[model samples]
Target chain A: MSSKKQASSQLRVGDNPLVKWLLVGLTLFLTAILLVVPLIAIFQQAFVEGAAHYFNSLLEADTLHAIGLTLLVAALTVPVNLVFGVMLAWSVTRFEFPGRKLLMTLMDIPFAVSPVVAGLLYLLLYGNNGWIGAWLYEQDIQLMFAWPGIVMVTVFVTCPFVARELIPLMQQQGREDEEAAVILGASGWQLFRRVTLPNIKWALIYGVILTNARAVGEFGAVSVVSGNIRGETNTLPLHVQLQYEDYQAAAAFASASLLAFIALLTLLFKAFIEWRQERQEATL
Target chain B: MSILIEHISKTFGQFQALSPLSLDIQEGEMIGLLGPSGSGKTTLLRIIAGLEGADTGRIQFGDRDVTNLHVRDRRVGFVFQNYALFRHMTVADNVAFGLDVLPRKERPSPSEIKKRVMHLLDMVQLAHLANRFPSQLSGGQKQRIALARALATQPEVLLLDEPFGALDAKVRKELRRWLRGLHEELGFTSVFVTHDQEEALELSDRVVVMSNGYIEQVDKPGDLYASPNSRFVFDFLGNANVFEGKADQGKWLNQQASLQLPKGIEQQDGQLYVRSHEFFVSDAPTEQANLPLKVVAINPIGAEVRLELSPIGWQSKDIWEIDLPHKAFDQHGYEKGQTVFVTPKAGYFFADDLAQPTPLHW
Candidate 1:
């Protein structure tokens, strides 16, 4: 009976190793096919013609303008989102006030709403004869088919990223440290700049990375409000779509490759920031 | 400076954290608020430090009413239980935080702040750790750094809540002695809150035993220990043998047992009390005072042997404890379940009047 029990235990333990390896192999296979294969395909397509052609086409005026506009949007949206996101996070976590729950739910609305709905909502509010747009149009002020319209859409799309990242972190941190600072005679501004800022610095950085990535990659929202004006409102993602529609295969793939490269860099940055934060929290 | 606390009360929702309590703290005295958890020791200390506000009361610190004052404006130093050292700052910077908060007109120069920080660090014997962050230090080191930080501002009063509560046994013992020495050297008016009876007994100039948001007794360490004003203080301070017998005129009687009442216990009910070490074995009855007893358990604890005796006259499991020296036990050769007569030491008073239980544990 003992030998039979030992044999069954041995079989059970032996079966797990094979199962574990099989699961690991399955994961690797899927990752290779889904992510790596597409990346390799894009790289192959970019260099199919020639490195010289790829390099020459990258510096084209249209491509340059599209890249510039995408960069401009990311730069504009990230800092504003960073500040507002931190303030909202602070309010939700540090202060108790009326309508706190409502404010929190409102902050998360952008995350749950579809990007298409977001763009459509902006159009309804800011279009030529819609809501406040008619009054602006009477004064010859244009929002739709403009950079301001594109920026507004990008901000709306990326707004929740920073605050979402910070809220949970600030909540976990509580108000003990800030209270300690206050009791130690630190002024309100000094308490924020010193005690509050340093603690949430990494989370804020992570949020900014997520915001900038989304802002750069935003296509649905920008496409609707930008009116797809060539060389003017044509951001990189929109430019890639335009190139694809125009049947400029190589150029389309080339710009798509650039967008993918930027995304890859952002992902790598996000990973690094997360790793550092984990290390800091472990030490704490 | 005298601190007069008048009917201070703090209530959180339906639960009363501190009731209408009044106390007076004399200047240059190290007072200990001794109690168990949730006994309002910490709440009282925080109220004194201006970290907490009493719902209905006034607090006078040296003729200046500080009931509504902010913690910083109270000019009081508070050392928290977990040390609460700011992790981002170096030891010197942590100590210098309060000093640096001074207005620019009254702020000390860089050299003076450095010198003072170093001086405080040296006082805590942690000058070597001045450059290290709080994360790099051990629990004991962190506590010392906290003490130094609290002392940096040179406040009028110092408050410590469970100063050694987070430390290990050996470190806590060493720091207890070290803290006593520092308190003596500093000569600051300090009030420390602790649940450890041994800590309060060993360190305080005056120990105030608190229970259920009220002060049970306040006296010097030796006086409180020798004659605890309540049963809670007695049990909390040390072990004792309590006999619940009534003193009728000059004799005490309960059930079928009877013994002569001591001098001070003539007028009290439940009037028999004896310290563990006060009882002694006697084969024959003593002329004036004696009791017949049976040894039920012999518990030897290091150099002292605690003998538990069952009452011979009383028909119950009422056990009395007697602590004899190891040599005395060896000389007597007493065994468990042995019967003998014992006489309590002379002048041992009946403590029935002070045997009321307080709602505090140690």
Candidate 2:
């Protein structure tokens, strides 16, 4: 016991300069090999054929169509998720009801399941030979191997983002302020619009950013559901895969670089938001 | 307007929060619900504010039944213990919230709202900090803003649940005086809940003493203190010394002490309750003396000295606390371990013991 106490007392930062330097060196070495090297390689490969060739490759009809389709899919998915997230979070946090824990667990199911499994689940429910698919086919409505299928898979993969961001925040805020508003003669909708919405706006924006990023970058689920149809169902990530398969290395790297750029932009935006939130909270 | 509560009772699952209770407040009266924690004071206050519905009750605001009305329509301003001010809004905006959230047809224009908010801020002495957020204000300032916001709608009745319970000692005293003054000038009927006996007695026109989900007594502060109706009220309202003894004929006797009972008292197990200041200590034993006690501890509070006394050679659980004024303490020169005979100047007795009482004063 005395020896343990002595060891704990001696365990201060910078106690062993050599060990600290070794750990720092190891961390940098691993980060360079794992992250920095691959990022540099992707940019290098994309620009190998020159900037003109790279820009031309991206301006191709099928690639432009894919980019437009990805944007369309994100546009449809992110808003739906945003609305659903706010409603679910509000209901779960503000009210007492039976099966609340079960509802929260169900909301988290998509996050726990593999993306490929999520895609396959949707496929089994909406594929041509599937139950719903056959009925829709009789009505001349095509859902499988189409843009709708791609959008559905993307929504499933990104559905939990906004609600996950908001549930804890609304719960922490509690019902006191809203109750105070109600007692102050604010109507139901007015309480929500004036009091609740402003409080959760930051978390809502953060959730939307995450959901949009996931919807734009989703590959596994969209591939399984979209059936890899070039220019029609292929999103940006799928287009990159198709370009690589055709042995067009320059085209593939150019498309991949676009995704990398988006991801980087998302990181920067998230960091800026987090910094702003921290400053606001400090004043609070 | 006066408020009336009739047969109000509440139960959460199997726990009985409040038994059948009724209270009436005259117009412009400042009443306090005084009790310890879980005594249903807050629950009763919330029911009055229309925030929580009583299981079986009818509430009326000057004969207009408000039992079924929503909180917004109740027009009763409520100040919570935590202040509940909107953190994102400035003090002026928070005060203006009630006016801003009114229905479009009833809503005031923006400039009118600013003027009314500024006026209320000035009333609360927060006009200088109107631009500051609640997070930037001290606890007292935040509570003042809460009070200003609650009053912005000109509520007929105001309800506060431990309004000063969250503040420190000095701030609480100052705000208590300020609130009393505000209520007098505004002429709004208000009910506040608090566990601090001093706060309740100091600020209230009348106090409702409650215990175990039941109303013990309701009276003016001086009356409640001088003549408590139950053993619970006697103990809860002030410092008390309890002595357990058996009533035999016209005398109450126990293993360590005996006292002359009031005339014609029944023979039964009884407990005598004496307020700390109601006892006198004498150096010489007299006929009125009940027991010789050794002073175990002496605590000199601000204006009075509290003496903890135990009967000499007594192994029973009874220990008497005698409070003497500083002048009396100086004259008697009582010290720790000094022996003195104790006699009750005034006391009350419950013939059925402390648990369930049958009051017989002596």
Candidate 3:
């Protein structure tokens, strides 16, 4: 026992034994340089005037309107995308039909296409003098350079985020559970509600949170369509860009800090879900 | 009246899964559909469970023609090989799921549903795991919960596909007996599919042997083992020594060896299969009436001895297997690479149908 203890003590740091701490030290060093320094810099730059001035600047009329529009767009886009994402995941995973592969490829088009290019495609379809735009303008149904146009572009740009997260998850959880429920005399609706929904609920919620974050931060696509009407169409990202152009750096960072806080909350929620799943697995 | 299938045929694209199959299952009879992989046993069970449809067939359950009925309307319970329990729901909720589907007027109250779920959990010996999720249970526990869930709705027929195939050897044996006891107690009309013949012969009241999309034979376990109808059925059910020999007036000769075939065999140029246990090895000249064999290898299993034997010119030929009781081997004291005389009692003979050439392969 004494020999074992002495050997263990000798095998500690700088003992030149088989075990080494070089990898751990290198990882920590890299993370501090690559991530922590920049985050600290951003926080210091944003909070230079402390909470008093920061709160006052955020409460300004234009800035407040921009934040409200950003939230409204996210609230509209997240739930809509959640429902469509689940439906799309179900169809792409469970069924076999003509154009199935094409549908799968089309779901990823949003990720591959640039945000500016996406806004341009909708402009081609709904802008005045465009194919569908001429007929729409005749009936006084405006889309481009309006609230509807901003939402349309935002949906196009962030459409795949939710569905993409759900497809692989739904595919891994195949028809087994649903079939078991049906064998238990469950109706289609009951099976979806009780058995199917509970299994994919976490992934679906994570996808919605991420989609909301993406929707709030989107600037190029929304700016192309919003026309930057200060109080009406300007969302948080556009408002920040406008502030930077007007040389109001402190106010821009202050608003950017709010978006950053939301992003941090989303990350925390995702990490909590993953940690819970891991804990459950460890118990099993 | 129970369930009757008439002339069922199914094909997935170009591959035929089942071909004009017909079977009848009696009420409260626990029958097993025994076959290897891709032998259409699972397909037949799926068709009966309403999980799959036969291309051209009529299924009658009592007086109802349920061939085209939806799965939810069939009222049949199916247990998958993997158990297929919902990983998110607790054990009680998984069992009470079917009870929750009844109409409001006909449905049981929440407390009543709880009592029924508890009763089901007790039946499967899983009452202690009532609140645990499926991922939290062992394989045996999951299977028990799946069985309880299947029985929850009081289904007319229960179908299981390789119920214990995924379990360890010891667990599989224990569950086989447990399942048998459960069937005896509940008297459910069950059809279980498995590739293991021992499992089929042990658990089932009657076994249906299938191969290549067609059922070759169906009979009681003891009778099916003593006498199989075809070479495929015989070889698949157990180990056998198959010989392709010619008949000359009165005696059958081995194809490439000098040993005379067993007496009382039919005078036909066909294949003959004899169970390994039916033949006994003895010293040369000790039994003049027995056929001479050269023992090539000896492998001792639990209580039996597997002997790989060869005839006179057995160098370039099929090897014959012989299984002897450990007591018999110890009593005779026959060592490997020694000459021995063997005799097999005449039981059955069948022509090999797999010898036929396929047009598609050509």
Residue-level error in angstroms, candidate 1, position B335: 9.0
DockQ of 3: 0.63
lDDT of 2: 0.89
Ranking by TM-score: 2, 3, 1
Report interface Cα RMSD per prediction: 1.8, 0.7, 1.5
Off by over 4 Å in 1: A1-15, A96-106, A124-145, A167-174, A274-284, B231-362
lDDT of 1 by residue, B1-362 (tens): 56788999987678788889888888888999999898899999888887778899999998898888887678777888877777788889999988888778878999999999999999999999999988889999999998888888887688898999999989999998998888788878889999999899898999999888888899999988766767667657755666666667676566656556544433556545567777667776665344667888888897899888888766433468888999888898987777777666632343455545322110
> What is the C-alpha local distance difference test score of each model?
0.83, 0.89, 0.81
For candidate 1, give the lDDT of residue B160.
94
Which regions in candidate 2 have their CA more than 4 angstroms from the true location? A1-25, B248-254, B257-267, B282-297, B308-320, B327-342, B353-362
What would the per-residue lDDT of candidate 3 be over residues B1-362, giving only the tens digit for each residue? Answer: 38899999999989999999898889988888998899999899989888888999889988899998988888887889998887777889888888898768879999999999999898889999999988888888888888998888878788998999888888889989998998888877899999999999999989999988898999999988766767677779877776565666554456444334345444556555667886646665332233567889999988898888887643324688888898888888778889887766543555334432111100
lDDT of 1 by residue, A1-284 (tens): 99999988777655777788999999999999999999888878877788888877778899899999999989899988998998889988977788999999998888888888888999999999789999999999999889999999999999999999999988987776776666677778878887888888888998998899899999888888999988899999999988889987778788889989988999999899989978876876
Q: List DockQ for all candidates.
A: 0.35, 0.77, 0.63
Provide the lowest-lDDT 10-residue window in model 3 chain B: B353-362
> What is the DockQ (computed on Cα atoms) for candidate 1?
0.35
TM-score of chain B of 2: 0.93
What value does the interface RMSD of model 2 take?
A: 0.7
RMSD of each: 5.4, 3.3, 4.9
DockQ measured for candidate 2: 0.77
